[model samples]
Target: MVRLNCVLLIDDDEPTNYLNEKLIREAGCADTVVTKESGEEGLEYLVSCAEGNIALPDLIFLDINMPAMNGWEFLEEYRKLDESIQSQVLLIMLSTSLNPDDHKRAEEMQEVAGFIHKPFTTITLEEILEDYFKSNGN
Candidate 1:
């Protein structure tokens, strides 16, 4: 498997973040895995990277439900960022929501690489990597 430079996980739940981070590490998915408790904090990290002239994470796993800024709200704000800053990143939705509407909404967004159900498994991560990164000759 190709190891990514970094990955970001944005979720309000502490356990979710911990588990997801552990899963990614065990799977050897990336060199760095960053966990943020809220969408606002995730955005701040991204902005800081841009300001400091640093590379952004290769993938961002965003949760749908958050306290202040929801995933959708964060996405809207993300769109306002420079294209260069977002060019190499794949933004995927990671949620426990069983609502089909959420899935559909994710599909409608061009920036969304995929929507993953919560409690992420290694198999799901493998598929995402294969489908998005490998297939595209990354």
Candidate 2:
């Protein structure tokens, strides 16, 4: 069996983070699950890891709206990172918003791997893992 990758979850909702972290862990989709309450903190963590040549997470689950910084703002900063380090991470936007514009914008972003609705379940985690493996040619 392939070893699961590390996951970085960026969401402001405490319950959502707790539940998603539980589901992701139970689904065996990640070896380590790191969560940040805001996009700014998430970006700071990534930037620090990049500077130290540390292993970056394989995926990032970002929420659209947060107190510190929104997902759009995170992406804007993420784009400024060195291409080598930037290319190592895959971003997935997770939001409760049912807005078509949000989905469209996420699709347009090259760094975004996919979009998932809020309150992720085991089934969704399984699908995400499958997709991730397939994309990585595993």
TM-score of each candidate structure, all chains considered together: 0.95, 0.91
lDDT of 2 by residue, 7-120 (tens): 899999999999988888876657899999998889888988888877888888999988857889989998888898767877889999899999999999998889989778
Model 1 Cα lDDT, one tens digit per residue, 44-82: 999998899887999999999999899999999998888
| Global lDDT of model 1 | 0.91
Q: Which candidate has the highest TM-score of all? A: 1
Count the clashes in each prediction.
0, 0
- Candidate maximizing lDDT: 1
* lDDT of model 1, residue 50: 86
Please report the TM-score between candidate 2 and the true structure: 0.91
Question: Which portions of model 2 show Cα errors greater than 4 Å?
Answer: 135-138
